[model samples]
Target: MDHISREVDRTQELAGVMSKIEMNHRAFCFANVKDAKFPLVGGLYNSLERFGDALGHNGPEPFTHADFDGRIEAAKAEPIQPLTVDSGLTKENVITGDAINLHDLPVPTFFELDSGPFITGAIGVTRDPGSGELNIGIYRTLIIDRNHFVINASSMSDLRRIYSSWEATGETMPIAIALGVPPAMLIGGSCKLPPNMCEFGVAGALAGEPIQLVKCEDSDLLAPADAEIVIEGTVNFSNRVENLLGEFAGQYGPEDAPVTQVNTITHRNDAMFYSIVAGRHPEHNTLGNVAVYGVQRSIAASIREVAPEVIDLEVLLEPAMGTLAHVVVSIDKHSDAQPRDIIERIFAASGNIFPVSKITKRIIVVDDDIDVHDPVDVRWAVWNRAATETKFMVIPGIESWELERAAKAGQKSVRIGIDATMDLEDIDKLLRPIIPGIDEINLEDYLD
Candidate 1:
């Protein structure tokens, strides 16, 4: 419940207080922003429980029943509904031309080495040039001046490809940056869907309803109608140097991206600007798990194709391991060779969006008894059951993630695979000790 003051430069203060709140698993707000009319809110998605609740799954084991595969399939099969042009965005305030000043916003600089204040929570809305399919994604935007900023899209991102297409045609790409959008849209925008897929439809499927949209004041691009703030602009083809931003991997990521010219800024009367604390904090890491949902499903599908004995798969998004770097699989295998084969197949597996081989750094295979979701249980199985000679594997000279610290000159690195299941010959000797009727015992009754 910390209340930030309206100091001239509260960036450092906000970052310091945010760090404290994250460690304590609490949410806080900036009741007073220095130059902005709206307050800034953060830490809404700091924990898995909070994230699950935001997604409207309040039941026990929310993520287990999220059904990402079903939602993705539905999005692909269903046609996207037309965006509704609502007047909510301009009902209260609208700034255009020279009146559009980015300095009025409460964007924060989270780290000492950070280039400047960045907008980490806004979803960029654009469309594919050829197909006219809608595309939405979260891209880090660096505010340059009063009405200018650079939007950083990674080389592999769809926005980059779309920008290239627009550049080839010598046309300025129209884009809209929507802040404080629905949680479902945030999750949908983060997913790596096929080029033909519409993230708006995916968002609709996720929320069991279509998201309301508003046409941008300056461009034809549509943004979330209920968004707290929307910046309407067109992409400038000129490349801009974006030095660094503290990323979820607990490291600084630098990039060069195209600049954007803001034409219009619109918001609600009582708008509340949303910000995700940048860096390797809880909110940053937990919110990043949304991006792994699609990858996990793709990996599971690939593993099942080669090894039908696979029971469960868990892709760990823990900050230390980085996002989607570590994967644990539980399987009922018939032979010792299955684990190695599964590992190779997974590394070779082509994902629906991005290649699985490119993202996974470590793969661990365990027996059905092991809970792949529990890191402690997985480590215990690896320590006690893995054979020194046959259970470990290393594949060298593989292309690793660009942000991985250990990546080589060309981003090439080694991948590790571990078979943590019990040896087929010593199954009886490796049984875990259990207390009888432990699940039926109630600690509350005994306490009384």
Candidate 2:
């Protein structure tokens, strides 16, 4: 959580040029990266342990998965209001008229196959005209020109919903892209909170303080008062451009993205642009993982309400899977049929428990001994516990996202679930191998 306000040459147009800096900084947790004319903030949420540290919970002992989940769940309960300020640091340098240019910013082309430079960390802020509720989410943008940029409006997002309404009424949706805010604010933007809730409020709850905000000069939108940079613009629904956009999964897929026309660009006098290179990188994947995990927390809570035996749940860490393609759950089994019952209930709770169930294709169930967050433990349970032929079950003819489409059967997809837990009857008799007193050994005392 270190901040450095300095300057560096940003004329380098090569893609992934700054990714080396993010990679190097990740080697050391919370390392200060002051690269280019503006300081490139890297290593933010590079790992789950570092993410816990950034959230101000860096105790003497490393945080466990449950510790991380508890903090996120607590924030959802009581959200704090953001403070309104007359002016913000972002307005210290405002550019308008013909001088507005995207090249001036250190927009890095992360991968070699990317079509052009992209703004990976910019959180697009848009408001629903009908309800006036503000929605903030991260949408990768391509710099097409000085004032024109193509925004990826794919996925079932609140921002996309607002844009659809604007398109229906033949109106342009006003949007403000905020970059380089506090860590909490950036993480808040990545979550898909309730439609009525604002990410600014969530950020305030995480920080345990009200986030300072200032009204944009051109629009009725509010932005972080201390953000490094903010770009205000309007997106035309009718005028669109189709491009093989580069995704975080390292694929160039065609998306008819909405085009945004920049109206004003604002930043601080010593603005440091924060860039996250897209691909299967931790910096990019970790953002979605943390946000999606918050939603999974709520989903797990709902599942526990119906079935109290469910102990822990986690969305697998695969960037190509788009954060929700796979899920792992640990439960205190009571009956032989509990595993299949848990999977059925979870799948049926789609849209209610999971806002986007299409992103999940596989769900695995394990006993309470297995740590759902630990891949090694989960794999071990899967290999040793499940009855390979009979425990595996599949449900077909389900809705799916385009990225995971396997057949030309419209939106239909298949889901698989494996009962990786031991048989209920054998649980009491069979015992897992373990060394005596191993758990009592203090690692710190032994290593030092």
Candidate 3:
């Protein structure tokens, strides 16, 4: 829920944050866990591997396995499983009498640097008190008092706009938050949907069926059919220092963001709470790569010429740096023309990636053959394929994910760019000399 935090009220969103303390990123379904050799702690860890199946480049079973088809597919594969009841958790629908309370749930403290333990993946559906137009944003909520939280939202976000309008009059905006909608709904909440597009509707489209939602308690807003939990609240932007917490970005964000007062909380009888590992993406946060993969087709189209060889893009969440920082590119540069230009273009092309990468020196670009999704593979390319003189280039500083001094002024850095292609001078000769026995082995069988 790094992309949006109100959705944090749900089970999966909570799972992303709680996974940190728990250190478990397994999927909701057993099949995903059953098939892969390695366990997945976060959602959509590697876009390249999953993208292969999504685009018909691979088989449909893997797509289903990776949940590329999303919530509807998940439901189809496993069917509707009901949540039970509990004082802390529940199975009650949003519209029911049980749909009340902004407390009683174990919301997570997602990051070390956060001002407080913040709820990572909650989808807040707030209505413009005056206009009454519904706006859905995935915003992070930091619990300050049982009644309030600090919402980290940008001026560009719908929540910010709607809440700001309320703050102009010293009034609070009404909000509804839901947890554990279909995975597609969470992705949609994080996605750059069209203006006035109901994320719930987009979620349904992604699922290949209309998402079943129930009316939220004490509000006109609606939540998912099988939501594990839901929260309702109001916020006054004028409230200061409400939640002066650290954030997923591994730095202290200004508590001046705004304050949210949660009045009521509700959930299914036996609701399942979720937690996400806050700080990273490759192996930590899901928001960056989720968005990267979420928008790859769009990004691919946007920078087609600038980054043509980029058959894929993956956001490697650096554990040291939180989400939004340290994005690695797997470029398929066919020409000698400045591939750095592609990196520069893509650095700007991505939506949330720009600001975090500003301080960083380089957007490391490895060849398509190198699995950008794998740190070991990318590291290997940096050693062998990278020529300090020929492979890397410098670019002026902009907002970057570089944890170092890249974003700071006078901190120009030569971004290392590797033209790791077969196009390189007889690079194939240098390839790991495959011995007969080792090369002949069926690695896929072993992988299975």
CA shift of 259, model 2, Å: 1.1
Give me the candidate number with maximum TM-score. Answer: 1
lDDT of 1 by residue, 1-448 (tens): 5566655355877777777876787777787767776788887777777755765766555554255445545655773564586666534688887888988888888899998889998999998889988899999999889988988897557998998899999987998888888877887888787786878887886677777887777777788888899988878887666568988878888888888889999888888888888888887767676666656667667767766677998876567776446889998978888888888888887766557778888999999989998999999999999867779998899877676766778988888899998888989999999898998999999895
lDDT for model 2 comes to: 0.73
TM-scores vs. true structure, each candidate? 0.87, 0.81, 0.60
lDDT of each residue in 144-175, candidate 2, tens digit only: 88888887866656777888777887766788
User: Ten-residue segment with the worst summed lDDT in candidate 2?
Assistant: 27-36
lDDT of every predicted structure (CA atoms) = 0.79, 0.73, 0.51
lDDT of 3: 0.51
**Model number with the top lDDT:** 1
Is 1 or 3 the stronger prediction by lDDT? Answer: 1
| Candidate 3 segments exceeding 4 Å error | 1-61, 64-103, 110-113, 128-133, 154-157, 164-172, 242-255, 281-288, 307-391, 401-406, 409-448
Candidate 1 weakest lDDT stretch, 10 residues = 63-72
**TM-score-superior candidate, 1 or 3:** 1
